[model samples]
Target: MRGWIIYKQNEMLLRQEAYEIHRLLEVAKEENIELQVFSPDQFDLTVTRDDEKSILIDGKRQELPDFVMPRMGAGTTYFTLAVIRHLERLGVYCVNSSHSIETVKDKLFAQQILAEKNLPTPDTMLVKFPVNVALVEKQIGFPVVVKTLSGSQGSGVFLSKSPGEFDDLMQLIEATSPKANIILQQFVKASHGRDLRVFTIGGRAIACMERNSNGENFKANVSLGGVGKLYPITPEIE
Candidate 1:
C-alpha cells in the first residue's frame, strides 16, 4: 500500500519531529507501506483532452497513491484543496474529503451544522466589527473561549475571563486584523486546562489521548508545551 502526506512547504522540508508527519511515516514504515511526504507546491495538476487528468510532482509524472492525507492544518489554501479535489477526480481516496474540510474550515459553520443535527455544542456567537461585549456576556457569559475561524495547536484560541479582557482582545484584533473572522463560545469549565484528543478513521475512533496544560494555560495543545497521555475511549468521547 502507498500513501501521500501533504503538508505546508516549510514544515515538510524542516521535518519537524514534533509534528504528526514524522510519526505517521514511522508507523507506515513498520507496516511495510510506502508513505511519501509532499508539499502542495510540489504538485501540478494537468487536465487534457477527453477530460483526462494527471499529476506531476516535483516536475515528474508519477503514479497516484492509494490514499492522501492532507495535514495543512489551518493554513490549508484554496490551491491545495483544488489539488486534493483533482486527486479525487483521478480516483484516489482522500482521508478527509475536501467537502468536509471546506465545511469545517469556518468554525462558526461547523458549530452551526453540529447544532442543527442536535449534537451538543457550546453556545457560540460570531464576532463582528464593533463587537458587542455586553451581548456576548449575556449569551455566552464571562470567561468565554474566543477562537479565530481557522487555527490549530491552540494558536488562535484565548480564554477571556472577563468582559474587560474580551473587549481588550477584540480591540487588539481590530487594530491588527480588522477583517478577521472569530467566534465566542461559552467556556466549558469542567474541561478547563485539559481535553481529549481523538483520532478517527473510516468513521470510527481509533485512538484517544488526554492533553493537559498542567494548570499553566487554558489551552491543552501539545504544540503549546502541554503534556499528553494515552486515554481510554469512553462513551462520551465516542
Candidate 2:
C-alpha cells in the first residue's frame, strides 16, 4: 500500500524529529508500505468549468496517493484541508476525513455539535462584542478556560482565575482585536492542570502520554514547557 503524510516541512525539520520519521519509514518499508512525505504548501489545485479538477505539486501534475495523513496542528487549516477534500474527489482516503477534521477544528462548533448529540463537553459560552463578564461568570464560574478560536500547543488559551481577571482579559481582547472570536469554558477543577494526550489513528488510541503543567502554568501543553510521561491506555481514556 502507498500512503502520503502531509506535514509542515520547515517546522518538522526545525523540531529535528527526523529520527522518528526515519524509524516510521523503515517500518513501512519492511511492511511493503510506500510512505511519502509532502509539505502542505507544495500543492496547487486547478478547477475547470467541466467540474473536473487536478493538482500540481511543485508545478507538476501529480499522481494521487492511496491515503493521506495531514499532520498539521493548527496553522494552514483551510489550505491543507482544501487539498485533502480535493484528493477525496479523486477517491483518495484521508486518515481523518476532511469533513470531520474541519468540523472539529472549530472549538465552538465542535462543542455545539457535541452538546446537540448529548455528548459530554465542557460548558461554554461564545462571546459577542461587549462581552458580559457577569454572564460569563454565572455560566462558567471563576477560574474558567478562555480560548481563542484558533490555537494549538495551549497557545491563545488562558485561565481567568477571578472575575476581575475575566473582565480584564475580555476588555483587552475587545480593545486589541475587536473581532476576535473567543469562548469561555467551564474549568474542570479536578484535572488540576493535567491531562492525557491520546494519539489516535483509524479511530483507536494506540498510545497515550500524560502532560503536566509542571506547577508553573494552568495549561498542560507540551509546547508550553509541560512535562510528559508515557502512559498506558485505560478504559477511561477510551
Candidate 3:
C-alpha cells in the first residue's frame, strides 16, 4: 500500500509539524504502507489528447497513490486545491474531500452553510465598508472577534472589546488593507482562555485536547503560549 501527504515540503517540514508528519510516516512504515511526502508546488498535472490524466513529480510521471493527505497552508491554498481536484479526477481518495475543503476555506461561506443546516455556531457578520455599527452591535455585541476570511493558526485574528475599539480597528484595517475580507463573530464569553480541540476521523471522535491560556492571554491555542492537556474521548465530547 502507498500514500502521499501533500504539503510544502521545503519550509513546513522544518517546523513543529515536521515531527507530526514524521510520526505518521513511521506509523505507516510499521503498517507496511509506504507514505511519501509530496510538495504541492513540485507537481504538474497534464491532461493528454487521449483523455489520460498524468501527474509529474519532480519532472517525472508517477503512478497515482492509493490515498492522499492534504496539508495545504494559507499561501498555496487555491493551487493545492486545484491539484487535489485533479487528483480526484484520477481516482485518488483524499482524507478531506476537495469540495468540503473549498467550502470551509471561505469562512463566511462555511458559516452560511452551517447556519442553513441549523448547526450551533457563533453569530457572525461579514465586514462591509461604511460599516453599520448599530447592526453590528445588535448582532455581534461588544468584545467582537474579528478574523480575516482565510486566516489560520491564530494569525489575522483580533478582538475589539468595545464599540470604539471596533471602530478604530476598522480604520486601521482600511488604512492597511482597504479591501481585506473580514468577518465579525460573536464572542463566546464563557469559553474565554480555555477551549477543547477535538480530533475526529471517519465521523468518530478519536482524541480531545484541552488548551488553557493559564491566565496569560484570551486565546487557548497551544501554538500561542497556551498549555495543552490531552483527555480520553467521552460521549459528551463526541
Q: Pick the candidate with the highest TM-score.
A: 1
For residues 156-194, could you state the per-residue lDDT of candidate 1 as single tens digits? 888888899889889999999999988999999888889
**Each prediction's TM-score against the native?**
0.91, 0.85, 0.90
Q: Residues 174-217, candidate 3, lDDT per residue (tens digit)?
A: 88888999999999888898888888888788999988989957
Model 2, span 1-238: residue lDDT tens: 8888777883345345544456666798999999887788888877554444346887987767778877675664788988888888778888778887777678898899989988678898888979877787788888889998776778888878898877888888899999988988999887777988889887788999999988868788877788899999998776
Q: Indicate the TM-score of model 3.
A: 0.90
Candidate 2 at 25: error in angstroms?
Answer: 4.0
Question: Which residue runs of candidate 1 sit more than 4 Å off their true CA positions?
Answer: 10-12, 49-53
| TM-score, cand. 2 | 0.85
Query: Whose lDDT is greatest here?
Result: 1
Clashing pairs in 1: none
Winner on lDDT between 1 and 3 is 1
Model 1: worst 10 consecutive residues (lDDT sum): 9-18
Q: What is candidate 3's CA lDDT for residue 200? A: 80
